[model samples]
Target: MSVTTTSRMRHLLTYAAFVAPAVLFFTMVILVPFMRAILFSFQDWNGISSDIRWAGWSNYTKMMSDTGFLKSFSFTIKYVLATTILLNVVGLLLALVLNLALKTRDFLRTAFFLPYVIGPVIIGFIWQFIITRLFSEVGKATGWVLFQKNWLSLPDYAFWSLIIVTIWHSAGYFMVIYLAALQGVPKDMLEAAEMDGAGRLKRFWHVVLPLIRPAMTINLFLAISSGFKGFDLNFALTKGGPFGTTESLAYHIYLDAFTKNLFTYASAKAVLFFLVLASITLVQVAVMKRREVEM
Candidate 1:
């Protein structure tokens, strides 16, 4: 081969060497399972058996008749909305507060980020005990109406409790993302705006926020996805308790497949979930990207 041809061949081999591992792993880990799920969604299999019957659209059709599944889906939506809003707001606020050069900024950042490092299931158990025991004692001592009830046992309070724990668990990680973005905001631009008689609040609203829009976009997407498929925390905290009022879609699906032996039904739900979440996230990201471009 000519020198140029030899160099091109070498480059092709180098690129393949770098990309081959990831492609193989993705196929083995993601693609294979996803394809299997699609197959499973079309069949009636009790998660284990020699008998696997083709059920066509029965699983999907059954979901329409399944009120609990429908309710669990609606519950998931409420959770997504609550966590998406609270996580973004609280995370952004924490990011703004900790970006300041306070004497305790470093310590505060570490403290804030610590919760995100802890596993959600463990956090759920801790909060469950705290609410059931510690808060009850405090309520008895202080006569505080808020802490008097067993919050986890009540539907309304259980819903709010889930939101609070999710926000507390995830807000710090998103805060770190926002903090990094905030640090990237052009200080000179803010100073120039200040020179133009723009107040601090005005500068923040117009300049700083616009610059950090990318991070906001990312945090919103993460919060939505995390909330939609919420399982571990909901499992550990409520176990869909009281009257199944706090049952997340994930837990509901888990019950259907593992508890009720409706593997095909649960697989169908998972497929629908993947589709709906993907569509919503895509639309949200697109809209936010457009807004970011405008700003």
Candidate 2:
């Protein structure tokens, strides 16, 4: 009844008008499904059938003995490590080069980033054709021993092939992030470092790196998460081939849920996957945040 109460009520309604849609969207799309998945992880159900059964801890316990699941997890960890390191290194290098004032700088940036615009599935298919078809043709024409080898048919090669494709697809994205960070580094700082008798490498190591720590944190986080959740390329390119050496955890989860019809078991694996990813990323952010320079 009072003017103060009426004004407060109006402000609350205005705030709710802006926030309500996002809250509802998150609840329906993410929160609800997440809770449902937790519930499903405790029950056995064919994805299509109505005959659901309570599974308790059986699904989670079974993972301890599942060799294929274990292998996929191991492979995923390796994939994450390889991709994260290579993506960051290659991306940073590309960023450094592209950041330079070259004549074709803008054009080169666009060319490099063009791959990231394509979907992983499409990139996989494209590279699949290139590796399997075009490479062989080129090899025969040029007598190139390197191209003659079947990159996708051998276990080690297949693993590296996946890493190569992942880096090709994503490196430009990471490069853009690093480029922005690099550009943000003060020119005066570099000049000051030079004036202090620091060489190029020393200047970059001491001045540039410390300044770009925020971007490094962001790029590292993206690389780790993207590496862990890698599936589309695995599905479209190799399909976990060459004795399943390149089967990522996400792909394995897909196999269990869709191919094996072990929905509850897959849900359990997904839950564990979430926990592991969350823990690793949290630790990464915490550690990186500590090292980040305020400037």
Candidate 3:
């Protein structure tokens, strides 16, 4: 009833008002689904059946013995590594180029980032058509053998094609991140390096890289996570085709739950996939944080 108590009550009400909507939404969507997924991982739910019987660790045991799942898991790791490295490298290069004084830098930045604005499903369809149709035509016209083979039909080619498309789509977005970080570098330090006879490459290697380590950390994390969890583009482009060689873990999870109606087994795979991602991300963050502190 006093002035302090009334002010405290009003602040509490304001906090509740802001937090209530998000809490309700999270419970309805993320928290509920996550809890249900954990339960389903231990059951024998066929995704459509009314009877759900607890099967203990049968799903996890089966997952370990499943050759297809193992193959997909391996493929996912390869994709993640390839895509992460390429995305970061290409993004950094683009950012460096754009950092130079150029009349078309803004235009180029928009052009590069435009692909990322498109939905992944749409990008997949566009790239699928280009690889299938345009590449063959261009090859015929130019006598180039770049598109001689069916890009989406061959396993190795399809895998690399997906990687290329993913990099093309994502590099620009990361470039923007790197560009912001690059702009934040102390210009006086760069000027000092130049005065000290540090050539461009030397400057980048010694001065620029250490200063941009924070951006590198963030960019690497995003690229790795996105690469590991990539699904829609693969679905549209390869659909785990050419004898299932292109099947990623995410696609495998979708297939198990939706296509095969093995919800419980899919849930187990999802849980395992989440743990793998978490472990890798945590290690990466710790290493990067240590490096940042050293810098």
Local accuracy of candidate 3 as per-residue lDDT tens digits, 92-121: 999999999999999999999999999989
For all candidates in order, the CA lDDT equals: 0.93, 0.93, 0.93
Assess every candidate by TM-score: 0.96, 0.96, 0.98
Model 2: clashing residue pairs?
Answer: none
Q: What would the TM-score be for candidate 1 when compared with the true structure?
A: 0.96
Model 3 segments more than 4 A misplaced:
none
Name the best candidate (by TM-score). 3
Tens-digit lDDT track for model 2 on 1-295?
9999999999999999999999999999999988888999999998889999999998899999999999999999999999999999999999999989999999989999999999999999999999999989999999999889899999998998899999999999999999999999999999998999999999999899998999999999999999999999999999999888889999999998999898888999999899999999999999999877354
Question: Which 10 residues in a row give candidate 2 its minimum summed lDDT?
Answer: 286-295
Overall local distance difference test of candidate 2: 0.93
Which regions of candidate 2 deviate over 4 angstroms? 293-295
